[model samples]
Target chain A: MREPTVRTQKIKKDTTRTRLIFFGILALILIICSVFCEYLTPYDPYLQDLKNAKAPPSLSHLFGTDRYGRDMLSRVIVGSKASIFSTLLLVGLVTVLGTMAGVFGGWHGKRIDTVLMRISDMFLAFPGLVFAMAVAGVLGGGLQNAIIALMAISWPKYARIARSETLVQKEAPYLKAARLSGSGTLKIVFKHILPNIIGPILVTSMLDIGTMMMELAGLSFLGLGAKPPTAEWGSRMSDARSLLSSAPWVTLSPGVAIFISVMIFNLLGDTIRDYADPKSRGR
Target chain B: MDQPALKVSHLTKVFTRKGQPDFTAVDHVSFSIQAGECAGLIGESGSGKTTVVNMITRLLDPTGGSIVLNGEDITRMRGKELRKVYARMQMVFQTPAESFDPRCTLGDGIGESLRNNGRSRRETRDEVARLMEVCGLSADFASRYPHQVSGGECQRAAIARALAIKPRLLICDEATSSLDVTIQKEIIALLNKLRREKDSDLSILFICHDIALVQQFCNRVLVLYKGKIVEQGEVDAVIRNPQDPYTRRLIDSIL
Candidate 1:
């Protein structure tokens, strides 16, 4: 019985490893395609051909043409750059800024903690997309402003996670031992505290990727992000929304692209979360 | 003849909470440990034994009074100066596994102080190996995480980490309390061997509630009750002739 259980456990471990690698590679491929999307496109995503307008999926135009006769497949391929990279940049920005604020607040933890945490609470109190829309409306329509708007609301979540994690880690006996061993405040925070607290923070960030992507796309769909002719996934979907019944391929092309990318990223995040937590590794 | 390794005079800690009365944890507690001495602070739970230890180790700020280590008044020390004082004094906590950073290997934990003090990676590695061996842990155990090792092994690793800097005063705050009897004895023996090897250069403040264990290991013992040092003397003398009523009750309970 024990031998069979051990064998089954090994199999489970192998399955998790496979899922991790598979999703990891898929995510990498998406990133690489985005980076070199120009070369990968079969036709100019921006070039207009009124004669081939609203042409359905065919040998020449694989995902059909939009009302402007721009190749939908090429447009979706190019849109990956704006869609994926912006989400990544947003997640990176929030994680660093929030983690720093949180670590500082937790470590110092007096008037500073109260002030910073209250500010974070204020941010958390706002409905995320509505607040982002308001900020985007003020900042004016563009991908950067939309990102900046979303960033304003998203950072507080990371800050809260980092703060709570840091608070728990700050009182850990190992930290006390480190302090007693003559490690300075900076060394203790960077070397000991940060490393220990990072696991949860990383998992949180990984899980946020899909959400940020959707939010960014939602902003673009709402005309608050990636203005006309930029070939962003959300904007492409927005541009083809009118043709939904007649030439559904135009809208579905970018929608499908968004779906696949989001699924890959979300699955990757799930796999990473499972792998990072030791308790979940066996099962 | 020389200065005592650690000295505490009128050390006090009062926990102040908003809308609540200030509670005195350690009140006017005073004690000193001479060089090469193993001084035990014995008290029941809630007697402020750990509170006194915390104040001395600088883990908690003293509400009043002073702590002198190796004749230097460190009561007001902070930042660089406080860190400098940390080199001379170190603490081994109650739970050995919890006292080690789970993310770090045993070697890194043991070598942290040495690395902080400007020892190169190679030197720290060599020193960590030697310290682990001295603490009766094999060199291979250095690669293991805190959870990977048994409680006794982790305790040994904790001891090695404490001794890495060759601190003049080592504070063991119930260091062996979590271990089984046999393992506890082994740890005590290991500490004894280390003290013998370090000779008069080392001083130990062994905090424990087990009076029998304290009597066997410590040279001098301070009995604490309600944050006050109720009785104190050479271990043998105090055991034979109980002084304070609290001390008498403590002895009677054990006898």
Candidate 2:
């Protein structure tokens, strides 16, 4: 019985490893495409052709043409730079900022912890998108403003995770040992605290990539994110929304692009989490 | 008169809660270890042995007391000053494996203090190897993580880490209690070797509930009961003729 169980566990481990590599490659490819999208597009995304407006999918234009006569495939390939990169940037910014704030608060718990945690609580209390809209509106709507808005609302979650993890690690004897070894506060936090607490934070950030992308697109759809002529996936979809019934391809093109990329990223995040967790490796 | 290596006067720790009265864990405990002396603090669980160790290591603030390490008053030290005092004193915790950062190798943990104190990388590496060897661990054990090593080996590594900076005072808070009987004897032997070799400089404050182990390792003994020192004297004297009821009970309970 034990032998069978061990064999099954080994099989499961192999499958997860294979899946991890598969999704990792797919995500990497998506990122690579977004980076070199300019060279990859067959047609200039911005160049309009009134003659081909609202044309259905064909061999020449695989995703059809929008009302502005922009090739849907070309537009999507170009839009990825803004859509994917901005989301990645937003996630990076929040992860760093939040983890810093959390570690600081957790390390020095007193008036500072109370104040910082309360501030995070205030951000968490608000509906995330609504707060982003309000912030974006106040900052004068643009992709940059929209990113700032999302960052302001998104960082609190990472902060919460990092803060809690830091709190748990704060009581570990190793920290005291480090302190006794003449390590200063910064050294202890960076060398001992951060490395131990980073696993959960990394997983959380990886999982947040897809959610953040969708939220960024949501902001663009609401006219708070990427503006017209920017070739952003959300704004492109928003621009073609009225053509849903007559020219469904126009609206569906960006939507499908968003769907495919989100699925890849989400699956990659799940695989990474599985890979990181030792217990999940079929123990 | 020479100052003791470690001296605590009227130490106390009160745990304050939201609606309940403050509970005192260590109540006005006082003790001192002369240079080169091995002083044992024996107490049952929740009898405030850990509280005293925590207070001495400055991991917990005493409600009312002063801690003097190496004849310098470190009771009010903070930040850089407190960190500087760590060079003179160090502690080994109950759980050997948990006393080290899980992410760091044993070598890193051992060399951490040396590097922090401005030693060159090459010097740190050489010193770590020497310390590992001195603590009965081979140089190859440096690359092994705490989880990969046996309890005795990890405890030895922990000892190596504590000894890296050559602290004048070593506080062992039930360091060997977590190990099995054979391993515990081995750790006690190691501590005994260190004490004999450094008899002129290093002082040890060995904390444990095992009266037999304390008698074997410690010269002086302080028996703690309900946050108070019920009795204290030479290890042999106290063991043979206990003064307080708690002390007698403690000695009787220890087989």
Candidate 3:
């Protein structure tokens, strides 16, 4: 057993509270963008504007026009729906599957653990992007398919993390105390180990959301994602690449959109990591 | 004489690390405690004090031993049978804070043993309060989490939990070592009070590194040196007229 550290007084002004508020606002904005994408944009992103082709940023068009005369601002706004949707779906699937697999693998050692971990190891051998790309290639091109592809490779990291956390938690004195007091194996794993390790997994999933979104964008740019006319960020970037010299805003708009979204997710993930850390609390 | 509350015969425990030679943790230790007797096992750290306690409480499997409680041999018990045996013999750990679940409230922690033994929630609630009252805890502490309480309060909570099951034997593994001097005294006094008031046939196996503490609480003392018992006698005799060299050294250190 570890010795108890001296309890420090709680700070009057909490930096963590401020960070949570900031992240909450960013998350709210992304949610709003996702739910009201169509109503928020003035012009249809798919409607071509031949008359205003390759126009610079001005009062009439906030992000100007693209090579095909499409409204770049409208495209970026509407594109968030697909990006956020796919990333969230991918994260949700991976978290549930990974946590269960990890808990079972850690709790029941020997043959079951060996088999589960071997599968995890096999997934780990391949780079996540390459595995996702291969899965995407085999499954063919679509939003749902892309999410499935990402999850196939993404779940291994979470499983490995959960398994290790479970292994450590299983040996804690409280767990033994619980067992001695007659808590069944299911109750011990779910009630004690799950709650203790879920915080880290949640933070990891939040960070993974940003990565999944980027991956989705990359796939779409390669013509393997949400197809043209769907107004996805990657598809827009793909269309604008050829006309980079004449219409730099076309490329820059989607690039900035992806950058801001990823930054918000990363910041949110960092704050969650700090807040969930037991060492940071009661200091 | 009435049947002994706990009986141990030829208890031996050996621990072997991977690719390392086997080491004896407890070498042929044997002892017995009558109902309501307080027996102390005194040793320095790594002297197998806890190892003996663990084997007796069924936390660790003894390599070769037979433990008979009330004429029942529990040396080979497993699963539900082992758990049933545990219900009759509870343990209070050295670190009070670590003994109780951090996530659970004090009352819940105390009530857990009862719940595990198949007591209903309502019955557990009432019994937990009664146990706490006996252990000198307020009813309001039932809702307070482990972290909210002081070290002394947590230790009291642990004692209350141990008593909840109405066990025939209580194994305290350096139970009050983590407490302050004043708190330790208070806990000792509380234990003595409870023992007298209940008139319970509760045998206590008090394991500690401090011989002085054992002298204050225990009727008999067993001195252990390097996983082997060097001396066993009345506390006064063992402390005052020590025959073993290890016992003399321990007494000199305390004095």
* Highest lDDT model number: 1
TM-scores across all candidates? Answer: 0.96, 0.96, 0.86
- Model 2 residue runs over 4 Å out of place are A1-13
Residue clash pairs of candidate 3: none
Off by over 4 Å in 3: A1-14, A36-75, A109-119, A227-229, A243-251, A278-282, B1-3, B71-73, B118-122, B236-245, B252-255
DockQ of model 2, rounded to 2 decimals = 0.85
Superior candidate under lDDT, 1 versus 2 = 1
Candidate 1 per-residue C-alpha lDDT over A121-199 given as tens digits, one digit per residue, 9 for 90 to 100: 8998999999999999999999999989998998888888888889999989999999988899999999999999999
Q: Candidates 2 and 3: which is better by TM-score?
A: 2
Instruction: Please provide, for model 3 over B1-255, each residue's C-alpha lDDT reduced to its tens digit, 9 standing for 90 to 100.
Output: 488999998899999898999999999998898889999999999999888987887778999979998778999888778878877888888888877766778888888878878899999999999989999999999999878889999999899988888888888899889898999999999988877876857889899888889999999999989989999999998888999999999999969
| DockQ: the better of candidates 1 and 3 | 1
Q: TM-score for candidate 3, please give it.
A: 0.86
Interface RMSD of each: 0.8, 0.7, 1.7
Sorting all predicted structures by TM-score, with the top scorer first, yields 2, 1, 3
* Top-scoring candidate (DockQ): 2
lDDT score for candidate 3 against the true structure: 0.86
Question: What's model 2's lDDT at B113?
Answer: 88
